[model samples]
Structures are given as C-alpha cells and as structure tokens.
Target: MEEQRPCLNKAEKGCEGPVEGRPSYAGTGTLIWRCTAHDNKAYEAAQETRTRYPDSSTPPGWFDPAAAGERWDDEY
Candidate 1:
C-alpha cells in the first residue's frame, strides 16, 4: 500500500493550534495529508514562496517581476 507524506505542517496528526511551518495567515486552506514513509513538505514551501514572491506573466519566464509585455502592466 502507498502511504502518505510525513510533513510537519498543520496537517500533521495531533497537530492542533497554529503550526510553525503551516500556512495560517491566508490561502485556499487546503488540507495536507500526513504520512510516515515520505514527506511532502515541498508543497507547503512552494505555496509560501509563491505567496511571498508573486510572479508576473509579463515575459519569458513569467517569474520575472519587472517584465514588460504588450502593455506595461501585462501581468498574469
């Protein structure tokens, strides 16, 4: 059987109250699964990074903040 990930976020078992690494302030409020075999902590980290550093789809990479596209404020 395939087991869930072992991430130390709010989704962790027996984890009540505000979790340290879990996204608490604002987000879609998705529930993360807890597992002992593996840890899917990357999801939370990526989410946090995305929230902290929002990318603009103005150009090539779409991750550039000062990218200029067809219009000045062509951000996606």
Candidate 2:
C-alpha cells in the first residue's frame, strides 16, 4: 500500500486530510507537506504577508518573500 502522509497544517487548521500536493519549503528551508486546501491557503497567506510586511521576515513554514517569483512546481 502507498504511504499516506498527514497534512502539515493539521494542528492549526484541524485538517484530517492526507497531503495532496508537492512538498514546499519554508523560509528556514524546512520541507512542508500539505493538503490541496491548505496548500492554496498557505500560498495566499504568504502573498498577503509579503505585501503587508515587505521588509520583514516571513512567517514560519512559509516561503521566503525574496522568492516570490519561484513556483512550487519548480522546487520539487
């Protein structure tokens, strides 16, 4: 049987879904896995945070603001 990985956002979002998208990297370069729902949510959140705090550090488990031009598909 294929291994099933739980969503990384389970604690924050109370999600019970398996990871459904490619893995992504956090600003700290940590690998993250999420379900499709949380993946989109995180991407949107990162964009908003980058817009609001252009000179500040990105939140944990988010992509670096400097890498805004990078796509998730290109990472893995």
Candidate 3:
C-alpha cells in the first residue's frame, strides 16, 4: 500500500487543508499538489515575480493582476 504524504507547509497552526492539484504546462499529465495556504502563497509570489520582471512573461496559471482580485483556484 502507498502511504499518502503529508502537506509540505509546516505552519504552526497546522493547516492540513485540502490538497489541490494544478496541471503542469510541460505537455505532461503531471499534477502538483499543495495545501490551500501554500497555493495562495505561490500565486502571490508569481504575481510579485511578474511585477519585478515586467518585460518578461510568466508561465501559464500565473496570477494576473488585470483580472482584478480574481482568485487563483478559478484558473487551476
């Protein structure tokens, strides 16, 4: 039997939130999983990176500020 791995986020509050899987854009059927909080953090980081590198393009699934407060779950 395969044992499921625990959430990677080690928050003191213990967030064992639902595991979310986002499709990889690498033309593969690989799905990456992360807790909700970490997912939000990842999206925020993407947004920041896009801002810092305005001329560069972010990969698919990155948070788009022009969407105006649209949460990331909608895209993923």
TM-score winner among the candidates? 2
Global lDDT of each candidate: 0.35, 0.57, 0.49
Per-residue alpha-carbon lDDT of candidate 3 for residues 1-76, written as tens digits (9 for 90 to 100): 8546444454423455776665422223445455676656655665675566655444445445433222333333
For candidate 3, the per-residue lDDT at 28 reads 38
**Residue 36 lDDT (model 3):** 70
Give a tens-digit lDDT track for model 1, residues 1-76.
8544444433334443332333321233444333322123444544555566566323233432211101214223
lDDT of 2 by residue, 2-59 (tens): 7677776666665645676454433545456677667777778767766766765434
Better of 1 and 3 by TM-score: 3
The alpha-carbon deviation from the true structure for residue 48 of candidate 1, after best TM-score superposition, in angstroms, is: 0.2
Candidate 3, pairs of clashing residues: none
Indicate whether candidate 1 or candidate 3 has the larger lDDT.
3
